[model samples]
Target: MARLFTGVVIYSFFVFLIMTPLKAKPSDKSKTKQNKYGIALIIGNKNYKDGVPPVDYAHNDAAAFKRYVIDILKFRERNIIYLRDATKANLDSALGTHNNVEGEVQSFVREGKSDVIIYYSGHGVPGVKSKRGLLLPTDATSNNAELVGYPIDQLYKNLSKIGAKSVTVFLEACFSGGSEGGMLIKNASPVFTRIEAPKSNLGITILSATSKAQLASWDNNAKHGMFTNYLLQGLYGAADQGEEGNKDGKVSLLEIKEWLNEEMTYNVKRQHKRRQIATVIGEENLILASVSPGRQFKPIQAFEKKKTVARAQRGAYQTPTISPSARASLNIHESYKSYGILPIKLKGKRCVPCENILIASLEGLPDAKILRGANARKADVVVSSFLSRLNVTQEANDAYASAKVMSGMFGAVLGKNIVDHIDRSTPPSFNIFDVELMLTAKDKNLGVSETARGIYFDRKDARQPKQSNTVKGINSVFRQAAERLAVRLMGGTPPPIKSAAQIRKQWEDKDQNAQNGNWSEDNND
Candidate 1:
């Protein structure tokens, strides 16, 4: 399937109000509904005893996210929790205690009985040097140099106990070098992880505000964490407005990343005159809650099934065929139709090919179910064996010459016309394999002719049988990136475009203007 890069809803509002039960009336289902509550926990710890004040913003960020959740997202006040550096009693009532935040989280989840999202903004230090990631709540203190924060494991365990299916966590803090050395943790930067939810098909998604080595900046203009500011912007409609799959009201994790990249890059530059990096980790297909005003179900089954089949077939190098019994068992239509992973023949081998490769790669990394096939069973293994034999005589000769390796992969799958303007006929050193495309005036009408040229793999030499593996790895990356591009561009049906005649007229006008030097000059004077 096309890799999605947009989330579906505003983080402040995780649930859409639909069919609320009567206030006084009571029914058996009402009990279940009461338990099915959605909760958002936002904390900004801006004050610290000995630590840096700028390192924490737990109060401001939490307040903003709370307002968004309630006012904008329409969540009830009782359903959400906001915490600052409150007393132990208030902390216990709101979240949990110093030693048992996990228990509180679990109990809240179980009692609430629904999806929960936790947002933490504060100073994050490596937890004892061995843990994956940790979230420091507002009450965190580091008196003895040993880092103390809410252990992520306990949070996961509590979420599991509560029978919640989906939980999203956002961490905006620095984790690289703490004043006091301790366990190295992964949560210092932006990170996302999806874990199995209890009693349901729900999952957890984690979004970190920065990379492990990068710092989450403060915005004097926004008076909020740079990452959080851009994040909120990405949420609450800016991203959804520009995204394709947002039609369903839910934004996928991939869409969120793309929107964040675009928004943060510009917003941060203008706001702080610097660039910040955020990392998104988790299930690619994980659905963020809907932001649409009404209850609208945009079932992804049709789209998901098609991409799954395509990915499976692409890996196996064979046509995907589902038996009637298996389809029935899986509760899927026997004759399923998908708009992704169109069937194609490569090297006389029947296989499914994604419309985009980068998306395929991103999706493939998370899904262990997709397996490699027999077509790549044999190849040379030497590091330079297969590469030395392939015909890579041309240097950066295609539209992808300037693109990042991942982007180049997308260009390859999109048939190249999307980026034909990039000319890479010559290059000094091609750090990564790139394809160059040359277009004729007549061919320009057909769009870009996408091609891949490079010695990605070779088995001609007896020493290296892993040649096929190298090629497969590279192709896999390309395929995944391509899928991401497709998801971004085709999330929704595209607008209609002009006919060839219109295109010719437009082209002719531009050509005539160019010949006469009729375009406006940069210097107005």
Candidate 2:
């Protein structure tokens, strides 16, 4: 009886053990918890069979963006669908409901809430009939835009139907195909048509590279589109605008927009000699992504180190030796320390606001002591500024006028076909703005001068009156120029300015080497 009872107890224990489940240990992939479920569709259509010029670095831009979203944003790789040189059919199938992105995203949303991000880097054509924005695929052509082009409004509507928590669209393509560098499309009318967002209750944000009439610029140095590069920079935490004490790890939509507006405008003006304003429409406080711990913002070592060394050297107060002849003309033995800023002189009709900006900028310098409303004799140096109106150079105006006459005559005498060819061959007029800063000794004998001039080709059909944003942009330019001049006057070397191309080249080479394991991701990530 005892042996039988022991056998029954052992049998019962074995059954219990067999029926029980054990908890599985989480792996590295599982350990990475996602705070918000997100899905991304990235498309870069570079190869175009038609007359449309191919976007040289579209594919590279897409790949880099993919790496950014996955590595830095902590997005699951499986949730991302990447397409390069995609055709119309591929886009249609992917976006359609037949076991495609729409269905997948919808299913994901139904299971759990998710955010959708749609990014496109390609050519965009303005719709003729409905004035809808159209994204050109690899198989699309200027003539067949209506048929092959992906309607941007349709895309918004489709994504909105998925019931995702939010939808963000990034269009790096330009409808005008006109860049600050030059025109991409030959002989196309420079009519600016705005891209309006579709009416949707779902939170939808659209960030466009340029306004309706502007060209989306490509930076050969960075090997990415200019807008996309800045976008990536923002994603990497360059957009963080929070105070140090209250530093949150997330980048807000407002921060990104502000960063893009300032950086893009500055870069386009500097590199392309054109004006490009990034457009953003959405809720400002939307959190795009939390900054990764490994990718926290770090100041550029080259710039920061140079500034530090300059400041230290300036603090030492070493006097610069002047030649006897120079001293005789200058009537100064020691360096000028305190400076007084005079109201900037306006040389042109439309530069009153520029004067105010220049004065404000001069006062903002750190090392300089600005003596306000003080007599010139009380200060060591007096700073004067002259701002000129934007003007078309004589050479540019002549060329444009000649082209217009020739094209008009050719269209009337020969044929409409010949007119387009002639018009395309003629370059547009260039607009230039000149700003000069003169620093003189209190005695008015010795002086040093600096100038900042900007040349741009206006792509807008008609110039609009200066708005607040325009005024602010102009102020920023003057401020930067003033800051550099102040540094020079104080016996300190201004930080070296890297060209957009040089910086982009370095970034591209670094990314390339990293892929080959010659560099570590720790540097950037």
Candidate 3:
């Protein structure tokens, strides 16, 4: 699948309403409807300690998310644990200590009876010593993070052991040192930190605010985090809107990821003018929310380790994996009928071969016609790809500072020329200009769109690969990126590129099957 950056929702009296659901009377302690089965731990930390940056409108974001939880997802209000500007003690009580997981937020799960939702909108800072990501509490200063701040990894661990049927976490805080909310760390500057997909337990999914090289942005006009607002909007029926969505009235995990990357990314690009994509972990194709009121999630057999797997299989292009029977409850998007490949550009220079390489890469993209020449303008969707130079020297140097923070003597070692002096360092040397691929697909005629981007050093380790800073290396990156983007643009998972010999073998097998009269239904030959 294409690596995407994006997620969000919004509601108001005058806002556009998609579909109104008939609410059921609440039997629980609170006045919320008895629809969704879950407990939610919502923390919107806005006011930070003195000198720390406040997450502007974070309290508003949490409040809005709560509204959706009740009004849309229909979770009873009594089951929710809401905290505004939560303190270190509050977070510890709610999420448990790093050493032991006894917090009500995780322990509140009723085994098979309740799913879990965790939403946090605050400042996340990296540990000065360990360099791990931490959610700074209102009372916790960025410098003393390891002592008072909440470890994001531990948060995952706590949530994973909840024994709930599923755990869905929505985080509006950016862990890479900055946010529209405020500067999280005291003297720390923002550096690109690739947030890894947590090793979540079965049925756990996490949708967070920003990609590796982005800061969490806010909608000043909306007085909400842009991610939080858009996510609310999506859950409120924008995700399941018309053809972009399945229109099934239920928003699935896949639908949410897709919708956010498309709608939120475009909106951010249009509004913030900087990249901020939502990153998701886990592939459980579960329904996240619904337009229909009081709809319940049907019981699926308990999540067994032996039963779950993720595959980018669609139509006839099934990946080489387990079996055909494994792919049930498939959330398939619409197959593109026609597409146009606009000229591929690198630093504003046209690269004809790059476009040709991309066109050739799309050979396995099923059920799509490539619009040719002038007719390309008439394509159902037009694809545009651009590659640009990215300088990471400053970011690299900041990482060295983080290295210094990790250990005092070690910090002294990674001094002014630390970016160059470190041997096998976590922060890579800034010898070469990194590349960023911005891939956009727009169906302007149909008011549909998607944006996906990948950076050369966009990884947790930030290790330099054998691919060097040369034309060949750039082309290599472009080829793979182009394929991934094209597949995603066409609404399919990127399949392994078929070799020329593999293609020949396929034809030879077809010929043999025809001669022997051994045609199979699946072959469709």
TM-score of each: 0.41, 0.48, 0.49
Please provide, for model 1 over 234-273, each residue's C-alpha lDDT reduced to its tens digit, 9 standing for 90 to 100: 5654555565335444566777788878777567667657
Worst 10 residues of 2 by lDDT: 304-313
Candidate 3 C-alpha lDDT tens digits along 1-525: 111100001111101221335487876432334655688998888877767878867766766676567655667666788787789899989988868788877666787778788999988776667767778889876667668878877888877776787788898977777666455666656654556678644456889988775888887767678788778777766777645788777777777788889977888888889988899877736778767543321111111111111111112334223233322211112343466778766667878766665554443333345665677668776777766555433234223433333334333533444423333443543443355666666775656665555445322223654334445546655665665664455344445554335554775676345334443522221
lDDT of each: 0.43, 0.58, 0.62
Which is the leading candidate under TM-score?
A: 3
| lDDT: the better of candidates 1 and 2 | 2
Task: After the best TM-score superposition of candidate 3, give how far the Cα of residue 425 lies from its true spot, in angstroms.
Answer: 81
lDDT of 2 by residue, 1-525 (tens): 443344334333433443469687775441235534778888877768756677876765665566566656666655777677788887886676323445444555643377778889888877666677778888876567767788777777777777777788888888764433344444566545577766757568989898867888877667678889888878777787433112466778888888888887789889879888888888888877666554632222212112121110122212333345444542322433556666544343445454444443343232234554546446656665543343332224223454465445444764565556445433463223222233332434355433333222222111223343344445645555554554444334454444335544675576455334343443221
Q: How many backbone clashes does candidate 3 have?
A: 17
Instruction: Give the count of colliding residue pairs in each prediction.
Output: 60, 1, 17
Q: Write down the RMSD of candidate 2 (Cα, Å).
A: 31.5
